[model samples]
Target: MSTNATTAQSPFDPDKSRIGRVLCFAAHPDDIDFGAAGTVAAWTAAGVEVSYCIMTDGDAGGFDPEQRDEIVRLRSEEQRRAAALVGVTDIHYLHERDGYLEPTHEVIRQVVRLIRQLRPDVVLAMHPERNWNRIQKSHPDHLAVGEAVTRAVYPALENPFAYPELAAAGLEAYKLPWLWLFAGPEERENHFVDVTAQVDRKLAAIHIHVSQHPDVEAMERTVRGLMGQTAERAGLPAGRSAEAFHVVTVNGPGTIAGF
Candidate 1:
């Protein structure tokens, strides 16, 4: 089934994408690297403007408790290199503590500011909804960033009255036409992006996160297997890879699943 701006269930096909600009909002430094780096590479290769907004510094992301500060510096540098690998240069870090994220008013306001400033045609974020069987998909930081970005996409962006300071600062309300939630609840994968040609680039980006994934061979197999599963689900041809997503309808009847 083909997809367009009008429908939510169809895949977020980069070929048919009307979106000129995109902002990928993520929890940790390497979240998008693992999940959507191929899609980002493809979108950039197609000349679509893409920016990354990583909410946390990822200080708590690694196994080594001894190299805390060094890990932060290493992860930040790694993320920049990884982003460049996929042709994404505009990377912003929000410096929030990795494990202590909560979707507070301040977090919402900060994300709202970023959303207004970037003004992407579509916002890509993690789905706050959890997958009980896959606990890794439901990381607290991911949920916090997702919820904060979701809030920014809705009433915060739709209602200028909600954030009066933003209006006073000349950053008025802005509506996001599309919200694509990556790594959603297991059954919520209604959208996908074919990454057949860019899967290698995705692997390379994930490789840059050496602090978290020192075992490259095992990581490769794990990631490739996951992407292959997604491709299978999307009905793509054998050897193809895909990134999955859940499309959330904004200002519609609650979540797309709510109705």
Candidate 2:
């Protein structure tokens, strides 16, 4: 995690011609919808093939205790619906238990397999660094997923010798060029996507997770305020909304040209 990213750093610029595929990894079902659905919508609109890999089925989420038994199925369906709204349909569920995720070798291998199978140019994941300012974003599950995926993206993905079983299974080693991390410390953010045009779709996606939000209206307001703040920090014009990320070029610099 201490790789000096000076040469690997860049802003948000997924040129459609160069960036063909993206793989988004999240700890739970609604994580992507809340953090990067708008940016995902924008990417899909530009014909980028985007896929999701949710580490957990969000069994520990939701406000109701009565539906605990069915939470897994409920959240899966909700996540699929939400992802569809933003033009994504291929979602891989690892089915890991929620609330107790860890950055173990098995999880990292699963992620590496998906990255090889997808061969995505960019992989969007949760930030590994704890967000001290936003305690909720630093959920244990989120941190674990971030660390696991980061490990998968680094030496594991590119080094053909790291995981022999994967290669034996025909999932050849692939190198990911870019990594974008969200829900991280604001000071670490180096990229901003102006998602003003896709805010409605983002909110709609979030609303699809009915079990998670008891007060949808309040959640929408809070999300708007947060996105607005990001827009202001990105120096976007007033009335604009944006999503922020800490971009990391995993392979080398000059892979993605910033806008």
The clash numbers for all candidates, in the given order, read: 0, 0
Local accuracy of candidate 1 as per-residue lDDT tens digits, 42-88: 87887788999998899888878787769889999999999999999
Off by over 4 Å in 2: 1-17, 253-259
lDDT of 2 by residue, 184-237 (tens): 999889878888989999999999999999998899999999999988888878
With candidate 2 superimposed using the best TM-score fit, by how many Å does residue 58's alpha carbon deviate from the native? Answer: 0.6
Cα displacement (Å) at residue 20, model 2: 0.7
Q: Tell me model 1's lDDT, rounded to 2 decimals.
A: 0.82
Alpha-carbon shift of residue 85 in model 1 (angstroms): 0.6
